[model samples]
Target chain A: MKTINTRRTIRKYSDKEVSDELLDRLLTEAARTQTMGNLQLYSVVVTRSMEGKERLAPAHFNQPMVTGAPVVLTICADYNRTSTWCRNRKAEPGYDNFLSFVNAATDALLYTQTFCNLAEEEGLGLCYLGTTVYMPQMIIDALNLPKLVMPVATITLGWPDEQPVLTDRLPTASFVHYETYHDYTPEDINLHYAAKEALEENRRFCEINNKETLAQIFTDIRYTKKDNEAMSEGMMEALKKQGFL
Target chain B: MKTINTRRTIRKYSDKEVSDELLDRLLTEAARTQTMGNLQLYSVVVTRSMEGKERLAPAHFNQPMVTGAPVVLTICADYNRTSTWCRNRKAEPGYDNFLSFVNAATDALLYTQTFCNLAEEEGLGLCYLGTTVYMPQMIIDALNLPKLVMPVATITLGWPDEQPVLTDRLPTASFVHYETYHDYTPEDINLHYAAKEALEENRRFCEINNKETLAQIFTDIRYTKKDNEAMSEGMMEALKKQGFL
Candidate 1:
């Protein structure tokens, strides 16, 4: 509980290396996480070598943590192994559709979060690179991922070299609904975002980005509509090429 | 770590009701989980009333845990609140796309796993109902979820009435790839699944189902191709209806 409460995304890592044994133990335990029907539809690719990290860095948009962290893990939604086993046992496999991909992705995310908590509990820090899904084709090629396997997320891990401040979250009332969803009113939205918009750092961010409001920075600069649509197209194409569409 | 290692899904629940205060604290803390740019594209609907659970039970195929547990949480991948905030802040939101839905779902799943761990640590037990996606339209109508708010998974939570044995998992090597993915050969597949196929319980399961191999049970009965394909069609329609496609 303490670890979950105090955990932060660590981008900077020390020179200390994470031993193979420790990584193995934590990952082994994390695999115990619940899955749909005991069919663990996930696989993790461990990138420890410099060349491997360099290959993946471009996929993650050259994030410095990709190269700095001693270990980079690419969590993937995998049905290949299970499918193969089914075929080998004279049972036809049928997990090559959109819903199957969704289920596998959920299993992969559950395993990813479980591993993150365990790694943090062991005094290790990590950061999730959301770019994995945005440029999944690059990751799939770099990792030689086969059909029925898609990269969902990436984690850069090592001993923490710095302590980052805890990020802010909207009040629980912002997201928690009782009995049924109560749509947020305009007044309710204003009340919920007051603290966030009032943050000094956020104001500084808006000024530096030359944006009128913080949301403009996100829509106009960071996650533009044009970019999101293009990426969505690419993602659909990749999913089709991977036999999941 | 011990809590994680020993945690098991509890389906049967004691009648002791979970207090609102305790649930609030855990949900509030779990909201601190990492998200894509801290956008927190997730919302949870807390269902405590029997009528609410009954409304959701059919969507989950009338899973005993749904109506049996003291509380049922429908974890949703929501872009409505964030998009609403952006719109109210004089920013046009362009998150009505597939990539946005994927990112929101990832955030929701991360929150779900974090909450499960925290809840287990507090001596509460829970089970994840994967059927949430298989029949999402039913849940959407039942919960009155607005557009851009799609239920991703459901959790049945309460005090435990039974302590089931820990479920089995494949050996770590079966899924953990070093440097890059090493495709499993036919021999490797046999070697990895040998123990699972040899398990007495699994063998009995196959015998009862009148299947020759354990994999047949999954391919034929549990997750058949016909069902997966039909569900995929429904899910896509639901996504389109939810303004995510």
Candidate 2:
């Protein structure tokens, strides 16, 4: 519980190597996490070699953590192994569809988080790369993922080199609804975002970016309309190519 | 750590109530979870009243846990709140797309797993209902979920009335690959699944279903090709209707 409350994403790592025995132990324990129908529709491709990390760095936008961490894990939503088994047993596989992709992806993510929590509890540091979905083709090529297998998330892991402050979040009331969703009104939106917009760091961020408001920093600079549309198109194409569309 | 390793799904619940104070505390702590850019991008709808549970029961295929548990939580991927704040701050929103939906869904799932871990640690029991995505339109109507908001998962929570055995998983080797994905061969597949197929429970399951093999039980009865295709179509329609296309 304390680990859940005090956990922070670690981006920087020391030069310590993560032993195979420890990594295997943590993953084995995390594999005990509950899954849908006990299907366990997920797999992880671990990259510990410097050459392998370098191959994956471009897909992650060359983030320092990709090369700096001792271990880089590309967690995938995998139906390949399952489908192969089904075929061998004379069962026609039906998991090459969109809903199946969502199911497998959910399983992969849940397993990733469980592994992350266990890793953090072991004093290992890690950061999740959001770029995994942005460029799936490159990751697929780099990791040699076949049909029915798609990378959903990437984590860079090693011993901690720095302790960062916890990130801020919207108040509980902002995200929790009773019985049903209570749509946010203009006043409610303002009240919910007041503290976040007023943060000194956020104010400085807008000033530095020449933005009019904190929200503009997100909409105009961080996650722009043009980029989101393009990325969405690319993701759809990748999903189709992977036979999940 | 022990919590993660020993946790099992709890579908049956006692008559004892879950205190609102305790629920809020757990949620607040779980909110500390890491997310993409700290955007959060997720919401939870808490259903406590019997009428609300009954309304949602059909969506979850009338699963007894819907009405049996002390509380049901519909965890959602939401971009409405953030977009509203952006509009209020003189910023244009552009999150009505698939990539944005994926990001929000990932955030929601990570939060769900983190909350489950913490809840299990506190001796509270919960089970995830995979039916959330299969009938999204029904849940949308029941929860009054608006545009840019989609329910991605559901959890029923309460004091445990039954202790289920730990679910079985394929060997870690089946899911973990070093450096790159080593595609499974027919021989490799047989080796990987031998233990699972050899289980007496699975053998009995196949017999009960009148199936030739374990995989036939899943392909023919549990997750059939026709059902998966139909559900995939339905899910895509719901995503479009929810403005995530």
Candidate 3:
């Protein structure tokens, strides 16, 4: 309970190196997370060398954590390994489709979260890079991923250098609907996001960006529709090249 | 680590009610998981009523766990609340794209995994329903989810009624790669899956299913190519209707 309550996403890391033994233990725990048919349709690529980090960093739009953390782990939605196993056993495997992609991706994400929690429990900090899906083609080339294997998410991990403030969240009421989804009225929306919009940090951000509202900074600058569309198209292409279309 | 190691999917549940207070604690822990850009793009619909579960059961192919558990959580990738907040603040929000869907889905998944782990620590058992994505439209209608909110996953939770055997998994070396993915040779594949294939349980399953190999059971029956294609199309349609295309 104490560990759950104090969790935070740490971006900056200390110089202390994460041991291979610790990583292996954490990974073993991660593999224990629930999986579909116990197939465990995921894999991790460990980038420890400077050259490896440099190669993979651009795929994440050069996020500082890509290079700053002691380890960069790329979590992939993988069927290649399983497919090969089945083929060798005289079983024909057919996992090349969108449904399969979702299955593999779900397996990947669950394993990733379990690994993150275990890492935190072991006194290490971590950051997830969402760019893995957006620019997956680049990641595939960087990681040498083959057919039936696609990068879905990535994480950088090490000891923390800074104690960043825990970020805010919507009130539990705002998200926890009873029995069924309770569609938000305009009033409900206002009530739910009121505290977040009024935060001093958000106010500073809006003003600093010369935007009239906090969301303008997001739409106009950060995750604009134009960029989202392009990235989505790129992801589709990557999925096709990886034979999951 | 203990919590993870001993975890198993519990399909049968004891006739015990889950308290609201305990559910709240688990959710709070879930909200602490990492988010994309600090925008928590997810919500959950909690179902405790028998009628509600019955309505949701068909979407999961009438899986007994759907109605058997005391609590069912339908986790969604939601952009509605955040988009409304942006629009109300005089900022144009544009998250109607695949990249945004990926972001929201990732956020929802991490939160779900955290909640599951926390619940296990508190002595509850759970099972994830992958059928949620395959038949999302039925879930959308059943849950009354509005635009910009899509059910990405579902889980049933309660105290255990059965202690199911833990399932098997591929070796860690089969998935983990150093710096790059190590595509498996036929020999590598055989070396990796030998134990699983030699298991008496798997051999019995192959014979009982009238399949020559275990993978034949997956491809020819459980996860057939035809079913995968049909379901993938259904999911794509749901994605468009949810405004995440």
Candidate 4:
């Protein structure tokens, strides 16, 4: 509970290298994370070399952490290996569609988060790159990912360079529904988000953006519709090519 | 590391009811999990009543854990609240699409896993239901989920009544590549899964099913192509109705 409750997303990293042995130890242990029917439909590409990081940076929109961290782990939703196993054993495999993709993606994400939890516990700093899905085509090319495999997300890892304060979350009520989903009424939304909106950092962000409400900073600047749609279209096309669509 | 390393999936749970306060505390702590651009696009439905679990059980194919566990959490890929924030703050929102769905699903999964980790650390046991996506429409209606909200997965939680032994995983080398995805060769597959295939339990499973190999068990029975395609079609239709397609 202590390790999990105090965990923070780490963006900055020192120059110290993460030893291969440590990476192996954490990963081998995290491999115990529960998977779909125990198929283990996921893979990871560890990027430590200069060329690998440089090539993969643009896929994450050139996030500095890509190059700064000693390792960038590209977690892939992969089913090729399992399909190969079936074929080798004289059985036909049918995991090439959207449902199969969903299953594999689920496996990949569970594996990714478990690894992150263990890595954080080992004193490693890390950041998740959600950009991996939006520009998956770029990742596919950069990482030579074949059909039936896609990078779900990437994480940059190293020793921490700085300490950042923990971020605030909405009151538990905002997110947790009772026996059934409690749809948010306007009043419920306000009640749930009151403390977060009242935070000093949120107020500062609103002021910095010259916005009346902190949420405007999100809608008008942080996550615009234009960017989201453009990325969405690209994602659909990539999903098609990867044979998930 | 020790805790996470030895963690196993728990399907059998004692009838001890989880307190509401404990659930709230763990969830509140878990919401600090990093999200896409801090958008925190997820919500969870907590089911503790027998009626609630029974309603959701069919969606999970009535897995015994669904009815046995004291609590069932349906974690959702949510955007309604965030979009509401945008509109209330006088900003246009464009998250009713597939790209946004991916982001929110990623957020929801991370949140659920973090909560599971904390719950496990607090000496509770849990198992994730992969059936959430297969019958999402039933889950949507059962949970009264609104548009822009879809169940990503369900996890059953309770005090453990059984201590399941740890499951095995593929060798780290089979899944971990350097610089790029390392496609599996037949020899590599054999080398990686040799111990698993040679296990007495697996060999017994093959013999019981009259299968030539362990892989045949999956292809022929566990995850057949016929079921996958049927489920994928249904899922696409459901996603479209939910405004994500």
Q: What's the lDDT for all of these models?
A: 0.93, 0.91, 0.89, 0.87
- Candidate 4 clashing pairs? none
Candidate 2 chain A weakest lDDT stretch, 10 residues: A1-10
Docking class of 1: high
Stretches of candidate 4 off by over 4 Å are: none
Give one digit per residue, the lDDT tens place, for model 4 in B1-245. 46777788899988687898898888888887889877789999989889999999999888899989999999999998888877766778888888899999999998888787788888889999999999899999999988999899899999999988777778889889999887888898889889899989999999999999999899999999999999999888888888887
Candidate 3 chain A lowest-lDDT run of ten: A1-10
How far does residue A223 in candidate 3 sit from its true spot (Å)? 0.8
**Candidate 2 lDDT for residue A148:** 91
Candidate 2 residue lDDT tens string, B38-103: 989999999999999999999999989999999999999999888888999999999999999999
lDDT of 1 by residue, B177-228 (tens): 9988999899999989998999999999999999999999999999999999
The TM-score that candidate 3 achieves is 0.98
RMSD (CA, Å), each prediction:
0.7, 0.9, 1.2, 1.3
DockQ of each: 0.86, 0.87, 0.80, 0.78
Q: In CAPRI terms, where does candidate 4 land?
A: medium
What is the full ranking by TM-score, best candidate first?
1, 2, 3, 4
Model 1: per-residue lDDT, tens digit, A8-85?
Answer: 999999999899999999999998789999889999999999999999999888989999999999999999999999
Winning candidate number (DockQ): 2
Work out the iRMS of candidate 4. 1.3
RMSD of 3: 1.2
Give the lDDT ranking, best first.
1, 2, 3, 4
Which 10 consecutive positions of candidate 3 chain B have the poorest summed lDDT?
B166-175
The residue-level lDDT of candidate 4 at B194 comes to: 95
